[model samples]
Target: MTSPDVLDSYAPVVAEWYSANARDLPWRRAGTTPWGVLVSEVMLQQTPVVRVAPAWHEWLARWPTPAALAADQPGEAIRAWGRLGYPRRALRLHECAVAITERHGGVVPSVLDELLALPGVGTYTARAVAAFAYGQRHPVVDTNVRRVAARAVLGEPDAGPTTTAADLTLVESLLPLEPPLAALVSAALMELGAVVCVARTPRCGVCPLAERCRWLISGAPAPVGPTRRPQTYAGTDRQVRGKLLAVLRESHGPVAKDALDAVWGDQVQRERALAGLLEDGLVVTPAPGIYALP
Candidate 1:
């Protein structure tokens, strides 16, 4: 077997491993509609799978299609979002629903460019939808994919924070030619990264790539990048934003300014957080002294 053959050998083993080990994600079900996949992908963007699971089910139950979500008020969407932290994504997802209903005739677009043009769809997300929804062969490189490829293939302990154009090419070249196989392979690689090739403590023993890992051969050098920490929510803008949104989410319409002030004790910080949400279009001041979820 040649070098390409050697590289390609990993696919079958990975797919086999995936068959037995893959988590029973609803979106991965045989008859899962594209709308369900899109919803799962959007909700999974920055939130963890554990948090997204129930929300995903509840959301699909309420609005199984884009046209249905598009018909709902943004206020309801925010309330449904329920402390997801990044509330802006909720607004953008609502806009995406409206755009999909209007432009794509309520169908999730399969073309990468078409998906990219939709609001809130970024490079990773666009490719993910195209490949997963339509059986297209495109590299779906999220943080997990990047990290796994970096360590197992490129000999890098960690992928840098930013995804470069070259990173996409590197991952794309490894994808199988067959569309469905390629899609399965992409998900398998992501699963490997998330579960086995973890950031803090990689489980090399169970990893399919353990024997072939470049990082293992290179003696596992430290990451040549800035380290990060779990973000502190207390006294941060995120906490304040959560506080402000909670008030608006509970209210039917515009909440009195004084009512919002009751959520956070610090008057100045609460005001700033409300202003930030308004600037981000997550909230609107329907009246002079009242706030509401936008």
Candidate 2:
């Protein structure tokens, strides 16, 4: 790992690079409301920024704040989550809105623990919302930040397949004081990892972290390798679940199982997927064999 003195040199450069090259994503702008930040972070959980932007705008415009969403039906929220792949996030968001209204007086909680208590708010999301929305000094380690931290600070070729609590602490140590600056630096590291210090083809020649990177100094090694390719959607249970859920989402009342059966013909696999969704609480069997969104 690079010593703190060496690591310090790269910070200014990263901050500069971020300021100049960061994408003009709506949620990153100054004066963005906390609710806007919360919505963007949630939409971005398993979805890409490019796809989340328009949906974020629509959600915020319609709901504007937690109370607005709290008052609306969950069906509207699910439908508003158009083409985001994982529609469950919309439902969780609706739950979060209700929680915020009842528990936090309709305001996004600034404290990390309070944020974590919200529905669908995991460790990464909690820290992200705290740091990004409230400008708090917390480790906001997403996949991008993890990759950057491993390479730049530890000289590692790649981060582990999943996050650990230690990873959070290490990243937190790198953060400077002044909450806004800390937030910016966390974003800077992520941006560096995303665009320049990429997974497959790192642009080390132009990378600001090059001078201090342990990986570069050690002669970057090949990564340990991904454990698996992305889970395939084709003919998978997720596809079947999406199909079944789509029908119920479109219809107001309970949908006959026959209509859902028509979506995916594989009787055995289709039944398994539907059962899984029901078990996951994403679907409800209103009556005997009739399904609807929960």
Candidate 3:
């Protein structure tokens, strides 16, 4: 565990760096609501900021509030999801909106437990919304934040594959006593991880914490594991599913089974992908041979 003094020393440096270097993400804008923050967190999962920005703007323009989104069919949400990929997140957002509207009186809940209870809001997301949206003091640990913590505080090359209870405890311990300042530190740590302490190629030359970073002081050793290759998208089941969903999203009504078949050549793969989409509730068979977004 990093000593309290060292951890305390890290916050201001990282937070100052973030103040100057953080991206101008729309969700981080001064007047963005809790609903907007929640939406951004969901869209950012396994997706990049560039793709998410326009989609997020369009989504909020169409459905400004949870009540506004809840008033519409789930298909509209999926349709507006565009090519952001992982269309199920659209469904989950729709469900989350409905829950927020019905249970929380159309307001995004500020409580961490309440946020977690919403559809598709996991640990990272719950803490993110609580800290970023509500400005509550919560350790908002994501992949970037985890990596920063591992390398900077623990003197490791990288974090474990999954976040552990120890990770949360360590991060929480680093937070400042003030709720708002702690939130700022959390955001700063995340920003540093994203832009400076990135996984493949860290820009340590420009990092604010370089002098004090444990990994840098110890020679920044290479991670001891086989390098993982990026997954290919072409000709995969994921590609087929995206194609099928595209057809459905473009259509105002149910699409014929033949329409989906035209997108992918492999019948087995196409069928499997379509079946997976149906199972995931990203698509619905409104008629015997026609599929539509649900």
Candidate 4:
């Protein structure tokens, strides 16, 4: 039942709002390299913007191009990753740099399929790079964009569990005709969802779409049943893995199993966590019972 006119108005209105209100992220700045956009996307996956800002600056300074990163060891990527959480992303990014070097002559590929072929690049990332980095008109749907589309267009409190094909179709339907403007609209939608139409306690009074939002017109009903569960980190294998990785990252050379063993008290949980890291290719067994980053 979503009106076509209302959806059509989204790009222009949100684009204007974003021009005045978008955050001053480095990656959004003019002349930022495609590699910068790629790195920022990977870092921003599960981490917050406030934390990502400095790390992003440092990362680009150290390895400004894929060629620079591809020249270094993968372990150096992990070391420079610096408490970003999900250190595996660092390894994947390293592999992505290598792929770019070998496959695309060290430049971030502009074509969506070529970008998607890089290690750890997913649909969202591929489309984001194509649209944001290359000025190609592709829908860049993330959690934030999905939520914005759901509430503003569908009158829903939240989006589905994850971005689906329908999500891409919905956003693409709203995009402007011109490629550059379409990219702008995509960024604007993400910014709106991130800041104004946030998951909890959205500040609708400040929202650009407050007057036309479907969810707002529908009384903004609370989500039905129990809300989605939040992820826990304490006492989990993830925490154990993080602790072990921190030890390895701080060390210049391979860390003995005893050193890793001392990081977590529970032998079973620690072993499980270490095994997971090894299986993930984040950690390598340089020798029997000796661990180092790959």
Residues 1-294, candidate 2: write the lDDT tens digits.
346766566667888989989988999887789899999989998788899999998998999999999999887888788778788889899999999999999999999999998889998899888988888888898898889889878889888878999899888778776788888898898888878998888999999778878889899988775657687779888888898888887887888879999998889999999889888777888799787776
Candidate 1 C-alpha lDDT tens digits along 149-176: 8887788899978778978987777788
Alpha-carbon RMSD, candidate 1: 2.1
**Per-candidate clash tally:** 0, 1, 0, 0
In TM-score terms, candidate 3 sits at 0.97
What TM-score does model 1 achieve against the real structure?
Answer: 0.94
Q: Which stretches of model 1 miss by more than 4 angstroms?
A: 1-3, 224-231
Best by TM-score: 4
lDDT measured at residue 253 in model 4 versus the true structure, 0 to 100: 94
lDDT scores in order = 0.85, 0.86, 0.92, 0.92
Q: What is the lDDT of residue 177 in candidate 2?
A: 69
Ranking by TM-score: 4, 3, 1, 2
Show the lowest summed lDDT stretch of 10 residues, model 3: 1-10
Off by over 4 Å in 2: 252-254
Worst 10 residues of 4 by lDDT: 224-233
